[model samples]
Target: MPSSPNLYVYHRGEIIPLEKAFLHISDLAVQRGYGIFDFFKIINGIPLFLDDYLARFYESARLMHLPVLLTPDELKKVLYRLMAQNQIPQSGIKMVLTGGYSEDGYTPAAPNLLITQQPITLLTAAQVQQGIQVITYSYIRDLAEAKTINYSTGIRLQPHMRAQGAQDILYHQNGIITECPRSNLFIVTHDNQVITPKKDVLKGITRKNVLEVAHQKYATVEGVVTLTDLAQAKEAFTTSTTKQILPVVQVDDQVIGNGKPGTVTLDLWQDLLSLEKQQALVRV
Candidate 1:
């Protein structure tokens, strides 16, 4: 049995203690930083959007030319076993696919898969109501559509973000808004149109659901978004698996729609939370 302090991790074909998981130093994932990963949340013991997350994971592996050894069903079985072993009620599962041990240190070999789960701290409703400020950085992520393990740029900008008293860094190519480091951006135009960038960004599962729900009440567009668009917006927010939906009340020194969480942003937050709870009930 896996003992105290060591969470169970699904590695290759077996579940083992976290400390037992290892990868050779010669692995391309280590030497060249070639790897892909995906994350999904668990609510009330039910994995949220596991299918979507799995699809994304496999797609990332495919894009990176890393072969996935287990089928989707097999991976799900192992994930369930790992979850049962860890018994983390509200947490997130991280799936990593690494370019296997490389003899030449560049070519990808028989890829390695590692899945681990850990507890996550969620934001409170009051905190959501309070909203957060963000700083805009002129940068774009490499391989924007894939969930690659490369977050060097964002991690390097942590100090810059903190100095600006911001919670997250929004990436922009020129004046076009791409996305936040960990979340997708959405802004409601002064005319009440909801828009999120469709290009050069990860297609987040939460963003998809938010769009589906937003379409019922507001006009939605998944297309190009720019800083000028953000500047003229009446409401702004972001979405992610962990963030669910959070309002962005300020960007740099500019106050967003009266410097408070807008009605549209708050309403969408409530709707998304309700949807998640409802899905958890049915899925569990």
Candidate 2:
């Protein structure tokens, strides 16, 4: 269950209750999984890097040829109104663009747009202290650059990950680490340099910010970080809009560097918070 019932959603140019938002049966997004989406977090009642996220959302829609039907300014107005309605200090916002309804065929008519906002729920202090375990899977997300509504690979891994008492699954291909189901993976080398997979992975908003801050202060490398390096690294963590910088104390059955969050991970996590507070767009 969600942490709260106060959800603000926008669909098809109309604001509606979350429960009232529905999709048609013949929608191409439902029938063929033809949809693009983006997710980001809010801070101090303000969305973080919304412009960047929206640009990528538009880019994905262009790649998939889905009609957005709203100008960026119009979309921003709707989004701001939705956020105001929710009235949360911080939240997670998602925008989904789907190929709209069609006849009894694969061809799409227009496109469907949806925006949802939920209160930002953070990991409890206990959870953070105890840390969480992660599992590795062979499933690699398709269209990694474009955040789409379809989640076939992640859906398939959920049951297995839960059965193993894990929170999420990290994906890999050809023995090279790619990313987690919903986060970007990073590792700290023996020399304390942060290493992350290059552009092949999703250019997540939080991931981008974290890397920028890390590079500005600490040594950082963006490249093909192999599974071998990840397993042997001094520390590991995953970054996302929600997770921020969560330490990966364990992978499968192997423990990473005393099976605890490393000093570098803690430093980067603090840096992330400082960066956000510094960059926050003050709200009235």
Q: Which sections of candidate 1 miss by over 4 Å?
A: 1-6
Specify the highest-lDDT model's number: 1
Q: What pairs collide in candidate 1?
A: none
Pick by TM-score: which candidate is best? 1
Instruction: Please report how far candidate 1 places residue 177 from its true position, in Å.
Output: 0.7
Query: What TM-score against the true fold does each predicted structure earn?
Result: 0.96, 0.93
Q: Please give the RMSD to the true structure for each candidate, in Å.
A: 2.0, 2.0
lDDT of 2 by residue, 195-283 (tens): 89985687888888889989977799999888789889999999987778899999999889989888888888889888888767655
lDDT of 1: 0.89
Candidate 1, residue 117: Cα displacement in angstroms equals 0.5
lDDT against true structure, model 2: 0.84
Model 2 residue runs over 4 Å out of place are 1-7
Could you tell me the lDDT of residue 256 within candidate 1? Answer: 87
Report, for all candidates in order, the number of backbone clashes.
0, 0
| Poorest stretch of ten by lDDT in candidate 1 | 1-10
